[model samples]
Target chain A: DVKVTQSSRYLVKRTGEKVFLECVQDMDHENMFWYRQDPGLGLRLIYFSYDVKMKEKGDIPEGYSVSREKKERFSLILESASTNQTSMYLCASSLWILAGGPGEQYFGPGTRLTVT
Target chain B: SQELEQSPQSLIVQEGKNLTINCTSSKTLYGLYWYKQKYGEGLIFLMMLQKGGEEKSHEKITAKLDEKKQQSSLHITASQPSHAGIYLCGADKGYGNKLVFGAGTILRVKS
Candidate 1:
């Protein structure tokens, strides 16, 4: 079975503090994604990586960045966190076939971040 | 541009009753996926539909995608207590890293 594990489940940070969220997948998948889920906004993609050192910006990518130094690990970085950034962060991984085919993105337990 | 929209933010029904959730999109969807998210947990994928006017079923649940490619429905036959959760519908143009999700439908099935 494919397993996607996150570094933390609950995190509390002060305003302007830097934070990092880590995600690792053992399925050897080629695509990794980061999304922040809000009540009414649903799940909005923050960043995604297809290969090592390759990253793409999603719809909401402000004040956040991602690093994909290895094939199995992806890290999301918040240079300066704010209260408005408090939300549930989810990491997902999926296998990329030859073309843009339908793939199930498996998600982790998610990390609930609270900034005060 | 808000690609997906789900109706009936919340619903409550008795066990054994049937329920349907709707998802509408502003743009044509190349694919649609249904997922269930429990409280304070991750999402579990239920089904995916690619072709328009297509229907798929699993156990007591059935999903249908309209031919117009703008709307989809998830029908649960004889709702059970275990089926209670936030049902989220998502769509994408092709199958890349990007997907837009709906706000989700919160369902509570009473026993």
Candidate 2:
């Protein structure tokens, strides 16, 4: 079974604070992603890394940045957190392909950040 | 931009009843994925359908992709309280790797 783990389940921070959320996958997958889930708006992609040291912006990546210094770990960074950034953060990882097709993503439990 | 629309934003069903959730896309789908998410938890993958007119089942949960590959339905038979959660459908964003998800349908099962 594949397992994805996040560094924190919940966190609270004041506005303008720098926040870091970490994710680690045990399956040695080559692709990792970060997303934020909000009520009504659904999950919006923040960033995705296809390989170590490689990153790409998704639909919504203005306030967020990502780091993939190693294969097993991916980190989401909020250079300066704002109250509007408070939401559930999700991390997912998957192989480039499975059975010659697009692979299914395995997600971590998530980190619920509260920016006050 | 690609978008996925899920119908019946929320549903309430009684135990032993059957219910279905639909996901529709404006463009052809390369792949469709079904996932269930408990409150405050990550998404649990339920099924994946790639080919049009394909159907797959897991226990009492069944998912079908339309012939046009632009729509999919997830049906649950003999519903149980454990089935209550948010159902989200994801579509391959044509980039061959990224995914775009629907707003999600929330299901509440009463015993």
Candidate 3:
């Protein structure tokens, strides 16, 4: 079975502080993505890395950036944390395909960030 | 921009009852996917439909993509307590590898 792990389950940060949320996948998949889940707004894409050192901005990438220094590791960074940035951050990884396969997305437990 | 909208923001069902969640797309759905997430958990891929008028079944869940390829439905038959969770519908327009998700439907099942 594929396993995706996130660095923290919960974190609290002050306003204007820089935040880092890490995710790792054991399957060595080619695609890694970050999304934020908010009530009523759903899961909005933040950023994604299709390969090492290659990143693309998803629909919602205003205050977030990502890094893929290695195949198994993807990190989500918040340049300046704000109260609005606090939400459940999800990490997902998939193989190299636009259309996913059966049980396509392998996700991490998620990091619940709280900015005060 | 591509958008997927899910209806019935929240639902309450009894055990052994049937429930359905709908997903509507603003643009053509190159690929539609269904996922489930327990509170405070990760999203679990349930099913995917690629072609128009396609339908697939798994256990008690059945997902169908309309012929227009712009909408889809996920039906849960004989709902159980374990079925209570947030159901999300996502779409990939074949433009990029990233997926766009809908505002999930929160289902609460009572025995």
- Which candidate achieves the best DockQ against the true structure? 2
TM-score for each model: 0.96, 0.97, 0.95
Off by over 4 Å in 3: A98-103
Q: For candidate 3, state the interface root-mean-square deviation in angstroms to 1 decimal.
A: 2.6
Residue pairs clashing in model 3 are none
Off by over 4 Å in 1: A98-100
**Model 1 agreement with the true structure over B12-99: per-residue lDDT tens digits:** 9999999999999988877899999998889999999989899999999999999998899999999999999999998864656456
lDDT of 1 by residue, A7-91 (tens): 9999999999999999999999999999999998889999989899999898899999999999999999999999999999999
Better of 2 and 3 by lDDT: 2
Per residue, candidate 3 scores C-alpha lDDT tens digits across B1-111 of 888889899999989999999999988887899999999999898999999999999999999999999999999999999999999998874665667889999999999
Candidate 2, residue A87: how far the Cα is off, in Å: 0.5
Please give the lDDT score at residue A3 for candidate 2: 99
Relative to the real complex, the DockQ score for model 2 comes to: 0.71
Candidate 3 residues A1-116, lDDT tens each? 78999999999999999999999999979999899999999988888888999999887899888889999999999999999998999999988864453236788999999999
Superposed Cα deviation of residue B64, candidate 3 (Å): 0.7
DockQ of each: 0.67, 0.71, 0.59
* Candidate 1, residue A35: lDDT: 94
